[model samples]
Every structure is written in C-alpha cells, then in structure tokens.
Target: MSSKRMATIMGVTYGIAAIMPFFVGDIRFIMHILIMCLIWAVVASCWDLIMGFAGIFSFGQVAFFVIGAYTSAILSVQWNVPSVVAILLAGVFTAGMGVIVGLPCLKLAGPYVALVTFGVHMTLMPVLRGEIGIALGSGGSQGILTIPPVNILGYTFSSANQIPTFYFTLFLSVVCTVIILAVIKSYWGTAFLALKDSEEFAMSLGVSAFKYKLMVFALTSFLTGVMGAFYGHYIGMLSTRMLELDLFCTLMVMLVVGGIGRFPGAILGAFITVTANELLAPLGAYRAVTLGALVVLLVLLLPNGVMGLWLKRSDAEA
Candidate 1:
C-alpha cells in the first residue's frame, strides 16, 4: 500500500475511535477503559519512538513519566499553576531530565545503555520515598490525593462526568499520534531508522548517532511527561507505585504486541492488552498468569506482532 493511502485509512480509523464514546451511550466504565487505553497508547507510542525507531533500549522511560506526574501534581497543588501550564512545564522538566540521563547513557551501546536506564528506573521510588521537604510535598507511600482535574479555558473536568475527561485525553492522544507519525515520516525519522538498522553505517553516512539518539530521547521523554501530567491530574492523585517496573513492562508488552516499528501498533497493542486486562479482572490470581501466557504465546506465534500479521496477510493477498 502507498503511504498516502495508508495514512488516509489510519486517519479515518482514529477519527472513528475519537467519536466512539458519543455512540456508546452512558457506559462510564467503557469510557474509562477507553481513556486508559488511549493514555497507555500514547506512552507506548513514545516508547516505540525511542526503543523501536531509535533502537535505544531505555527502561527508564517510566522514570521520566513519574517525574512529569510529580512535577505537574506539585505545581498544581502547591503553586496554584494552571493545568495546561503544569502539564507543559512537566514536559519541559522531564525533557531536561531526559537530556541529563540520555547524555551519559547514549554514549554507551546496547545492553550497557539498557542497564543504566534500568538502574534509573529502580531509583525513582527510593528517591521519592526519601524526599521529606515540605515544599516538595512527597507523596511517599500514601500518594498525593485530591489533585485538581484538568481545567482548560474555564472548563473543569470533574470526576462527576467522565465524558469530558475522555474527550480531552482522546484529543491529546490523537495529537500525540499525529506528531509521532509526522516524526517517523520526516528526514530525522529516516536517520533514526538508518541508525536503528546500523549505527556504524548511519554514522558513516554523516548521521550523527549521538545527536539523533539524544534528540529522540528528549523528544519522546517530553511526550511521556505530558501524558503523565494529564494522567496525574485527570485521575486526581499521584502515586509512586504508578512509576514501577510493572507499568514499564506493560508499556513494552503493548509496543511489542502491537508491532514495535509500526505506527498503529502502539494503539492496537494498548487497546487489546488493556481491554483484556479489564475483562480478566474477575480471574483473581490467575489473571497475571493468563496474561503472561498470552504474551508469551503471541510473541512466539506472531513474532512481529499483530500489525506484522496484518502486513503479512496483505502481502500474501497481493
């Protein structure tokens, strides 16, 4: 399929998804699920940008996410900053940290970089727990509660109505998706792909691995931070547990399950995984085991992920 045609189809599909809540009536639970899916979809997409596209195995993605949430929460609750401002500032702060973290780690290659990132991810909880300053307002284990919802243009997203929150998150997800797709289609994206395929070859061709790696690292971190801030405020609380390795693993699962390098794979992965998780909630202890088995089976059966299967079928038909 041509790029133009593929883009048109994706646009229409996302358009339908954006308007889906309106037709679903008053099913708040479904809307909530959809919102969560979109949030994770954005995070997964950001992950795909750095790991899948740039070939940077960054396990510290969740750390930037946690930083964004905490920054937004603290700014809004302690300093009376606006929701929009807080989220943007959170993105900025997280991006700055991404630079700080990426500078040292990006110099390393392969598993070394991954090890550094994993260490960073593991340190977030300990650091947050140790923060005892009154101005910082550490949530500790109890977490920060009563967080104000996102207020945009005098309209507040209260918990009483999930529809607005749903639409707001949906809009953000769509915007982020478009941005990521645009990046993937740009010259820098070509460089990223080249680097991913062969860092040595790309460097030989004048594509600076250092520059591209840091650029993508900071850019994806910014997106993750923005999503994290929205999540913190929309959910009306912030918890250090949300930054744990489990969430990072889930994001990875979504990316791999959907088709890591494909643009639509992130959304598909998050939707399928999150919906399955919710549906399997009644399974109790077996839920984790079942989900793990499913992931292992999918990885073994469909090595390239769901989108890979679709592509293969399309090619076969052609």
Candidate 2:
C-alpha cells in the first residue's frame, strides 16, 4: 500500500480507538487510560516536530507543557477565567516562552542545546513549587487543588461522567494531529527535513535554519501548551510532579519506541508505553525493571521502533 493510504488507515483506526471506550460500558478506568494515552500522543507529536523533524534535540519540551498547565490552572482557579479561554491564553503564553527559550538555545548545537533546554525544564520546578511567592497559585509541594473542571456549553466533565472528557480529549487529539500533519507535509516541513539532514547544505540551498528552527519551537510549544491546559483541567489539580523528569523520559521513550521521525510513531509509541506502564503496575517494584528491559530490547532489536517494523514489512512485501 502507498504511504498515504497507510496513513489514512492509521488515522481512521486511531479515531475508532478513541471512541471505543464509550461502547465498552462501565470500564471507566480503562477509558481513563485511553484518555491519558491520547494526551501523551499529542505531546509526543509536538516533541517530534522539534526533535525529529527540526533536528533540535530538546530534552526539555515538557517545560512548555508544564507552563501551559500551570498557566491555565492559575487563570481558571485564581483569575476566574473560563476554562476554554484560559486554555487558549495558556497556548499563547507557552508559545511566547518558547520563543524566549528558543532564541538563545537554538543558536547552540549538539549537547549544549540539550543541556540548556533541560536546565530550563528543571528551573521551572522550583517556581511552580511556590518558591516565587505562590507562583501560578502553586502551593509549593502542596501544589494546587480544586482546579476547575472543563465546562463546554453547559456540560461539565466530572468524575461521574468520564465519557465527555474522553471525547473532548479525543477531539483535541485529532485537531492536534491534523495540524501537525499538515505542517509536516508542507513546504516548511521540507525545509525542516533539509535542515535536519544537512544544515550547511540547506543554507546553501537558501533555507534559513534559524528561522525554521524558531518557528518549529514556537509552533510545537503552542500545541503542547494547549494539551497541558486540557490536562490540568481534566485532572482537576496541578503539582510539580506533573513536570517531573520521569514524565519527560516517558515522552522520549514513546518517540523512540514509535519510530522517531515517522508521523504515526508518536501515537503508536504513546499507546505502547502508556499501556505497558499500566499493565506492569501489578508487577510491584519490578515494573520499572520490566519496562526498562522492554524498551532496551525494542531499541536494540527494532531500532526505528514498532512503526519502523511495519514499514520494513511493507517494503519486503512490496
């Protein structure tokens, strides 16, 4: 099958999966897991835009995620802004910060860039922990509680009815996927690939590496920030734990396990990692060991990820 056809099938399959929980009946816990998967999928996709396509190794993309979540949480809980409005504002705020961070760091290359971005992510934890006078309404280690739930057109998503929130997250996921896909398939995406493959060559061909890099940073950060806002509202609380290194590591693993630069890799990796984590939860302390082993095996064996395996099969058949 052609790549386009495969992508279409994958998209349709994911859409169906998104709504499958509603038909499964009374398995709210599973539905919750699916919802989380969709959220991470969105985040991983955004991360791919910068790291995979743009060739920027950003270890701290989660900083934008945290910024977005806290921005929305503070706006809704402290300023009494509407949930939807706060989310939008959060996207804008995070994108602006992305520019601030990218401007300085994008000029650097290799491990230095990664280190700077990682530093930025670490530095935000203290601020979010209220080291800065209740910054973003966070109560230090206590965190923020009673975050307003997402309300849309008189319908509020609460613990009793998780279905609405699931659908809401699914809708946002679709939107994010479409937007990122569109950007990736555009001329700008070509520039990103060229920059990634060979920066000097791309510049020789009239592509501006700095410009595209900055754009990707701001754009991906906005999308991630929007998802973070949804997450804050959906969970009905916020804490520095949400911005932990473990979560960042999980996002990286998803990208690696899903096939890095491949578009579907983000979603596939997110599903696999999240599902695997949940399933291994019953394994007690050994869960981490098992999960780490699985990841190591996949990396060593598959290299490009599960999506890469599929592509390899397709090529062999063709």
> Candidate 1: what lDDT?
0.83
Candidate 1 has what TM-score?
0.93
Q: How many clashes in each candidate?
A: 0, 1
lDDT scores in order: 0.83, 0.84
Query: 217 in model 2: Cα distance from truth in Å?
Result: 0.5
lDDT of 2 by residue, 1-318 (tens): 244754684587587776687587479888888889989999998998888878888876788998999899889988999999999999999999898888887679868889988999989887777558285477678877888888888898755578877887888988898788878888888999899888999999999888998899899999999999889898888888967768988898899888788777888899889999999999999998899899999988877787666675654332
State every prediction's TM-score relative to the real structure. Answer: 0.93, 0.94
Q: Check candidate 1 and list the clashing pairs.
A: none
Q: After superposition, how far is residue 3 of candidate 1 from its true place, in Å?
A: 3.8
